[model samples]
Structures are given as structure tokens and as C-alpha cells.
Target: MKNFIHDDFLLETDHAKELYHDYAKNQPIIDYHSHLSPKELAGNRVFENMTQLWIDGDHYKWRAMRALGIPEKYITGEAPDSEKFNKWAETVPYALRNPLYHWTHLELNRYFGIGDLLTPKTAGKIYEECNAKLGLEDYSARGLIHRMNVEVVCTTDNPLDSLDHHRDLAESGWPVKVLPTFRPDGLITIEGAAFIDYLSSLSKITNIKIIDFETLGQAIKKRVEYFHKNGCRLSDHGLPHAYAMDFTEAEINNILSERLQGGTISKKEVAQYKSAVLGLLGGLYTEKNWTMQLHLGPIRNTNEVILSKVGFNAGVDSIGDFQQAEQLAGLLNGLNNKGHLPKTVLYNSNPNDNELFATMAGNFNGDGIKGKVQFGAAWWFLDQMDGITNQLNALSNMGLLSCSVGMLTDSRSFLSFPRHEYYRRILCNLLGKDIKAGLLPNDMEWIGKIVRDITYNNAKDFFQFPSYVEKAPLENG
Candidate 1:
């Protein structure tokens, strides 16, 4: 019997197979957005076992194991690494039709040369086989990145972070451009538990006491320059919804003063304050030519009972039914009117907002930048096959899909790079089926270039990494 994953895996037609093999298969990856660890890459850390490499810090697996009624000890508690791997293998058979099933096999085949489907029956041998090779020099953190032909990896970073690891990697000359993305969600979120302390660290780092709104912008401006000097060209935000409520600068200042004084703030006041801060940051981003990524619509920690055990970011978040279009259009329009709108990518966690986001992106594209406001890759819960297809279809129907910046892992795992391949296959299949249906022309040369461009070129130019990108040596190939 043939392996479940093969050259023709998701490709459904001859044209699809040719397009993937000829154009998209081997393009170098530009992971412009991800949650990967800069410290691991800097140190070239080696995995001691399969669980550490796959299960630890992966809430996807944790959620799956919990669904299988596996105890918390096996999922995230004090279970041994070997036992964790065993629990994950047992849950694999139950994960059918889930993205995790495909991702598990893809990572296994790409990284460890294991092709058998993961299940309880095959768990022990596969685990031992993977653990044996993970300690090899070629399986180190940097090695995994290079092995996947990654050209640039931009990691999400907090504003208060020193980015010393990025500096170390750049000077270490490791070839993969390990860069940082400015993520100031904490800075904008005034109601967060750690808001005051986070600002204190920001003030200390920039040496500008953030006593109020003006000083806060100044300190943030200094950090933007700091990041730009360190080769950062991207910024990211994670919010429940767009904050575009109208408010005067004085109101914002008063709100900041209220928060600083341990006074209460109303929900409307919070919205106004965040809107004011977002507008302020937009100008800062445009000044530095940064791409601001807004990842909206996640009602986090919905499972308070699960939260008690997982602390946070343990995969308990779900899609929020927040009002998106009006607030989002307001935010983008406010930025555009002020001439402070930088290149921006809009990501919506709720699938219902796909077309809304696609059409909204077109409203700001006349500023001489191609695909200025992007409908970013399907995100979080929506990164699977159906989500990817629907997102692409919406962009193709309402916006220019050809100039797309294309797929990103948006993942924290090193082995998740094959998701790019997963996306490419689905993309090619879409075009191929269209061609076979006579909906598109039989011009492989033209369509193939589109495939190649979407897979790699657009991202390289979109982020403009020419300034800091360092290519890995051919010997590493």
C-alpha cells in the first residue's frame, strides 16, 4: 500500500501535480510571522526526545489529549516525556479529519523520515526512532530551520524585550535571518493585569517615564527605532476586536491618568483609549515603513476551569462574535485619513468575517503600494484546508490574489514549516481544478509563475528583507 502522504498527496490533477513539483515545492520560506523561540535558534538547542520537540508548549496536542479523556498529568502535568509521547500517539487515531493528523504525519516524514500513520499501535517504535535522530547535530534548532529552507524567520516579540537574542543571532552569522517583530498588544491593553508593570519596564528601557499618553508615545517611538535598527520591519497586534471609538486626545490622557492613579475605567473609556493609542502607533509604524499586523477576534480564556490549570495560552481560546467591519473600517479609515496608515495585514479569527476583511483590504490599496492592506493567511482556528481555501477564494473574488503575500506558519513549533507545503498543494489544486473545468486557461507557464510568486517572491518583496536577510551557505543544503 502507498503511504498516506506522497508526492501527489493533496494534488488532484496532473496540472496540480506539475505546478507543485515544478514551482512551489522547493522555494525558500520567508516566515514573516511566527511564535518560534529566538533563544533556541541562537543556542542551536537539540531536542532530547520527541515529546519536547512536539508536545511541550503545543496546546493543539494538549487540547486533543484532553478531548481523548487523557488525564491532565499526561497532557500538561507531571507526566514523563515518554509518557506524554505515548498519550499523544494514542490520541492520533481519534484526530481524524483534523489538521493535527496531517500536520503530525508531515512533520514526522519531513523531519524524521517516518511515514507510518501515528497511532497507539505504532507509538513505541516511532517515538524511539525520532528520539534517536533528534540529538544529531543536523537536528538542532538552527539545523531544523535550515533543513526546511527557511530564508527569514520573524519571531513575535514584546516591546519590553531587549532583543539581545536577535542581536546575538545576527552577529553569530548563522545564515537564517532571525529577526524580531514588534508586538505591543500589552502596551495597548490597559485592562490587563500586568499593564502598569509592563509600562514601567518600557519606561525603564526607553528611559522615558510614561506618566501619560504623550510620554507613552515617546517611549514607544524610541522602541520602534530600536527595533528598526535591529532589522525589524514588522509589527503585530492581538486584540478581541478593532478599537476605533472616537475620542479627543485630552480624554485619552485623562483615561491614562485614571488608570495610572488606580482609578476605574469604563468599557467605553477603554475603547477610546485603545483607539487613540492605535492611531498614535500607526503614525510611528508608517514613519519606520513597518507592516502592522492586526490579528483580531479571539475571546480568550473562555474555559475558566481549564484556565485554572493551564495558566494561559494553553489552547482554550475560541472565535469571538465581535462586531468587526464597522470598527475595523473606522480604524483603517482613521489611519488613512491621518496619512499614518502603514502597510497593514488584517487577520480575522472568525471565518464569517472573511469576505468583509477581503473587501475592506481593497479600500486602502490606491496608495501606490501593491496589496497594501492584506487579508492575511487564515489564522488560529482557521488555518486548516477549508479555511485556507475560503480565504483564498474570498481574496480572489474581491481582491487581487496574484499579489498576495501568501501563507505563514503563525506557529510556535519548528517542525510546522511543512504547513507551507500543505498550503501550496491546496493552492495548486484550486487552480488546477479551475483549469480542468475550463474556468481558467491551460497556460501552465503563466499560472505556474503565480504559484511561485505566491509561494515565495511576494513575501520577499513585501517585507523588503534585502537589508538584513543572510542566506544559508549552499553546503548546508
Candidate 2:
């Protein structure tokens, strides 16, 4: 028996399904912030098999395996790919209510037309079939993007990246827009073990002698400018908590000097330095009109023993309970009162802070910029059905859902593109249920357009992709 309802498959009569088919089906994806390698994308690399396609770079699977009681030897270990797939197969049956189960089957169905539910019994068959198709031309990276309707993808990149692949894509003049996002996490964390070494690297990257705080600021500015010239319009940061400390210029400089001279700086000093740098970075974002994203409240790498063995993003990070609202308020209000706040999106990992996240978004959105301060959609661990629905409800209740930019993958696997569709299906279903209950009128045209905009067009416009008009050379008579 094929698991159709178990599939929760969208129906034709369902308003949400109609909306998805009518509006979002043919549109292109504009992934604003992802960790996908631009090099592989430009080269149009192919995957070896389903396991390699889905699990090779995905930390989500690693996390799920850990949750399923799989040993690390099989999770991130050197076990054969077949053994890993078998282990994952055993876990799939137990993952009944999990979004991964749905995502796994959906990818199989959409990509390979395989309708069989994935379980230990059916795993070998599905694996063999999918791996056979892996050799097809349509299975290549760019082909996968084309099949998924992805038009513009901006990969998160460090300050040290030369963006050679980005240049290649631009020169190729493909319809797909592959841009780079300036991620300065390496530069921003001034208390890490490699802080001074990273500073020297930044100096070399920008060819500026970063001897003082001002010099470091200048060096960062230079790199940002370079990134902008190469078609970057977004900046990303990962912070444990939003920095809101007050600091004097002398105070910040003294801390930087201490770190430079091999002196051990205390935790308080780290906070002040981070706060001061974040303020300056916020000011730059304001001046440049760039969209800035903060991934806040991640108690990163909670399993320190595993961290020491396997390193970051190996399924060890967890959400933290931090003073997010007040801290975010201070940082945002500082820029808001000055009329210099840029377009901002806040992503919180802690589900308990959903209201705090939603309300904080409202506080900084006073400039009549529709959807300016957005509470990011279910991110990381929250990218599931319950998570997405809850986030939508929160946004709809506290702010304007119609103005929201629907979903962003924030993912690593090409197979994870189905997540966008999953989000859209859930969104439409919510609206459909409302209409069916007479809460809203079932106007297909308007609702369809809204659906389209949310799933595809909103992200397109939000990220500022080059359009037909923009592509034409400017008149210079």
C-alpha cells in the first residue's frame, strides 16, 4: 500500500494545493543565506548516491541519528555509506511524526517518482533505484537547481574568500544568480583562540595594517566594499546573544591592545569588545542599505567532548535561554532612534522565545518598511511542520503574515529544497482552513498571488535580483 495520506499529499481541491500549483510551481528560488558551496554549484557537480546527496554535508541527519540512539561511529564516523543508509533506514520507521521522514519521502517522490514509504523493509529498494538515477545528466548540481526552480542563491562566505567561483558564475551569464554573502564570524569573535591570527589574515586580505580598533574597522569596511562590488547585498552573523553593552572608544582600544599583546582577556572584556564591534558593524549596514541577518541564541556545541572530537555543526549545538528581548531591544533601538537601522531579520533557535522574538521584530519596524524587522521562519531544528505552523501563527498574530517573506532554506543539502515546498504547503493549508471556516473569503486569484509572492516572488524582490529593466544599460546622453 502506498502511503498517500501518510504522505499528507496536497490535493487539487485544497486551496493551498491550488495556490502552490498556480503561483509557486513555476517560480524560481532566491536562497538568501545558505552554506552551499558556490564552487560545486558553478561546476555542476553530481552526487554519488542518495546517501551522499542527502547526508554528506547535512548536519540535520547527524542530529537525527544521535536522537535515534545511533552510535557516533555510524553517525559521523567512517562507516560505509551503505551501513549509514541502513542505520538511517532503521530510524525512519521511528521518525513517524518527524519532518525528516516527510522530507525524505517527498524528495524520493518528487525527484525519482518513487512513492514507496521509506522504512527498513523498503530502504534497499529505494536506495538502489535512486542511486541508479544518480548517473543521469539531470542529477547534476545545476540541473538539481533547475529542477527545483532555484534562480538566485547567495552562499555564506568568509571575509577571506576570493570568490573566484562567484566571478565564474557571473561571467557565464546564466539566468541563475549565484552571489556571495559577507559572513564575518571569523573576524567578529575577538575572544577565540585564533583571534589575533585571524586579525592578521584580515589585514592581509584588505592590505591594511590593523594595529588599532580604527584600523580593524577600516579593514572590515574595505572587505565589505569588495563583497558589495561582487554583488553581495546581505551580511550574516552567528551570536550566542545579542550584544548591547555600552563601551567607550578608549575602553575598546585597551581591550584590543591587551588581546594583541598576548594578555589573557576576561569574559567581560570579550563582551565589551564584541558589543563595540557589533555597533560599528550595524552602522555600516545602515549606511549601505544592506540586509543583515542575526542567528541568535544558539548555545553552540553543547557537547564539548563531541565538539573536541568532531568539531562544530556536528549535531552538538542546542538552543539557549538568554536575555534576548532586552538585548535585542537595546541594539535595535540604538539604531532605530538614530533613523539608521537597516533591513534586519532575526532568527532564534529557542522555541520558548517565540513571542519575545516576534515582539522584538515589531519594535524595530517603525519606519513603515513593510516586513522590515522580521521574525525569521522556523530555522535549524525548527524547520518542521509543527515548528513552521507555530512560527506562522506567531507572526500572523503579532505582525502581518501577508507582509512576511515566506521561507528560506538555511540548509546545506540540495535535497533540502523540498523544505520550501513543505513550508508553502503548510502555509496554504493554514490559510485554506481559515477560508473554509468563513474567516476569510476564498478568492483564488488574490490568494494565489499571495502564495506565489510568499514562496518565490517575495524573496526575489527582497534580495534585489537583477531584473529585465535593471539588465538594460543606463542611458548616458
**Global lDDT scores for all candidate models:** 0.89, 0.79
Model 1 root-mean-square deviation: 3.7
How close to the true structure is residue 334 of candidate 1, measured as C-alpha lDDT? 97
lDDT of 2 by residue, 1-477 (tens): 856533346533477577666766666667787888898888878888777887776777777888889987777789888888888888877887888888888888778888887788998998899899888888887777778877778899987788778777777767778888888888778878888899888887778888789998998887777777677888999998888788899989999998888788888888888877877888887777788899998888878888887887877777787878877888888777667678888998888888789988987776656788888888887889888888988888888777777787888887777777788778878887777778878898988788787777666666664442122111110
Q: Which ten residues in a row have the lowest lDDT in candidate 1?
A: 468-477
- Regions of candidate 1 where Cα sits further than 4 Å from its true position: 469-477
Sum up the clashes in candidate 2: 0
Cα shift from native, residue 124, model 2 (Å): 2.2
Ten contiguous residues minimizing lDDT sum, candidate 2: 468-477
C-alpha lDDT (0 to 100) for residue 188 of candidate 2 = 71
Model 1, global lDDT: 0.89
Candidate 1 residue lDDT tens string, 303-397: 88889987888879889999998999999999999999999999989999999999999998867788889999999898999999999999999
Candidate 1's TM-score:
0.97
